[model samples]
Target: MMYKSTLSVKKEIALHLLFWVIWVYFTLAVVDANGIHFAEMDLFSSTWCITYVVTFYVNYLFVLPKVFHPFKWIKAIAGLVVIFLFFAALRYFLEQFLTVQLFNVQNYNPGTGILYYIYDNTFYAARPIILSSAFWLIVLLVRLLDYNKYIIEEQKNTEIKFLKAQINPHFVFNTLNNIYSMVHFQSPNALPAIEKLSSIMRFTTYEAPRNFIRLGEELNYIHAYLELEELRHYDKSFVSWETTVQSDNHEIPPYLLSPLVENALKHGSYTAEIPIIIRLSCNDQQLDFEVINRIGNQKKDKLGGIGIDNLKNRLEILYPEKHTLQTTEQEGLFSAHLVIYFQ
Candidate 1:
């Protein structure tokens, strides 16, 4: 922390030096353009620049922050009045007294009234006052924007972690229930189902926690889950899945696809006549997935199993406007279609 603070201070000092350097160059340019002799203008411009720098820092360091708070406009006005007077008095002392005594030149007429001198210098003081305040305001705005971006990024990561955490337990609970049913029936498929469960659990434990995984790894998990489900139902032909991929190296959010499969198996009806239909096709541009199933005799909530709301939230966070998920029920069939465009 101390190192960072030192670095920040160094940068700030560099910026201030840069500002003054540029100001000096421009002031000299203007003075020379006015046809003043170079040697005399050096003395005048040096005094003027020094006075402007003092005015700039006085308001910056002492006045603006204290007076510029919310509900302090009256204080701000008073503060500016104080700065204007200070600037005029300081300039009068240096230019009228010191410069005249040393170089025999005075910026103002020797006999000018005090009020007119103060009023006339207002025009000069306005530049340093306004520019310095503007610089402060710009720095404050940029800091605020950086802090806001940091806060947003933190919130996004926290929510995604929460949503990812929810998926694993939900999937494990349903899979365990299927295994329990097979074990209670003393079915021959119980041992194979348990083995399949081990593979699924390994993926969920180790791989699923990552933000992304190889698309082929997720597909392998899906294949294991389907085989386990087939053993439970005692029918390999009742579920159909077709996948065409341009490459297996594409990355995907872990467990993103499994919920659709789980939802179908949990709520869908299966028979030789009308099997559950799952289709997926992926290319460099996008991924397309669809699942269709026959409606069963059992009542099912469209948004129930695997929680469509949860799925929708994850999709919105991960893909934003780049993906679409649509579901519809018509003519004894329920279907879900998902399309995700890669960035």
Candidate 2:
């Protein structure tokens, strides 16, 4: 696989849980002013846990978003005001409940201490908001990653469609036009060339849709295409194609290399007097190929790649940071150079 999935959600959750555990410990220590040790108490008491859940649900699901996002400012602030009064009444009753549970009395008040109100309402309530923010941040990251994956897939599909569209007609038109020209010239080898064309089309139409193909199969397709080119231009000056592929067991994206040769035949050897030379050299880890052609009056556009920008885009999107493509123009002749990662 060219793409690897990134960090998962559970890992992020575990990390957040660790941070929250530490913060809760430190927060309680600060609230107690070192008078109580967390190691000696059950922090998950019903009163504490209920309050935690309530604050977390309200802030995470409603309050913070209403405060932070737009158009809900007035409504959210008003809701917070109502919530503040409700909490004031609720805290008054909850203290009575705790008094009954732990002290056998339903009437008591911890009054005239500003710290108690600030600690209970403000800092403690902020816990769920903080935790949900972390979770939502992870959600945002995952969504962005998924969006990027979608974009890459779209670009790849478009590139493949363009390459398939460009090369199919280009190769066929050249072959058919060659046969058409040969039929008038009374060449004896025209029928066999057409048969080779059939084989080439068979592979393309049947197999090229696959994502990966054996290097040997791709090279065979190249050989079939080159044979058709040779048959079509038998009378043209000597043009030689030599492919010395080192490794055959690996797989690569199909039809990626065929366009280079097709371009060479279409443009490089358009004229009869000058020969176009193409060679494929490969190692266990890399494939290097080059095509050189003589410029002619009616030459196909040397801007390159089978009449579509798809080839360049494919090489870049699929093999970027792994492959290299360079085009150099010198002495009225043009060449396309490619190095594809093989291993």
Winning candidate number (lDDT): 1
- What TM-score would every model get versus the actual structure? 0.82, 0.71
Off by more than 4 A, model 2: 1-45, 61-93, 96-120, 150-158, 180-190, 270-274, 305-308, 341-343
Error of 1 at 59 (Å): 3.3
Which candidate comes out best when scored by TM-score?
1
TM-score of 1: 0.82
Name the runs in model 1 displaced over 4 angstroms. Answer: 1-18, 30-44, 67-75, 85-114, 304-306
lDDT of 1 at 337: 87
lDDT, candidate 2, 1-343, per-residue tens: 3544455567656865786687568755444566756554452344555565565556555665566555476875685665454444455456556556776654335454646664566654555546655555565578678779877787778777777677667767777887887788988888888888888788879777777888788878877777776776674344666779667756777777777766666666455455667778878779887877765557553755554366777677678788887777677677888888855
Weakest 10 consecutive residues of candidate 2 by summed lDDT: 39-48
Q: Write model 1 residue lDDT over 1-343, tens digit each, in one string.
A: 1112222556767878888777666655445566743344666677787889899999888888778665387898898999998898889889899998898998888799988988788899999999888877766676667667766767777787887788888878878988999999999999999999999989988998888998899889988988888898898888787889989788998877777877787788887679989899999999998889887777662646544567788899889999999889999888988899996
Cα displacement (angstroms), candidate 2, residue 335, comes to: 2.1
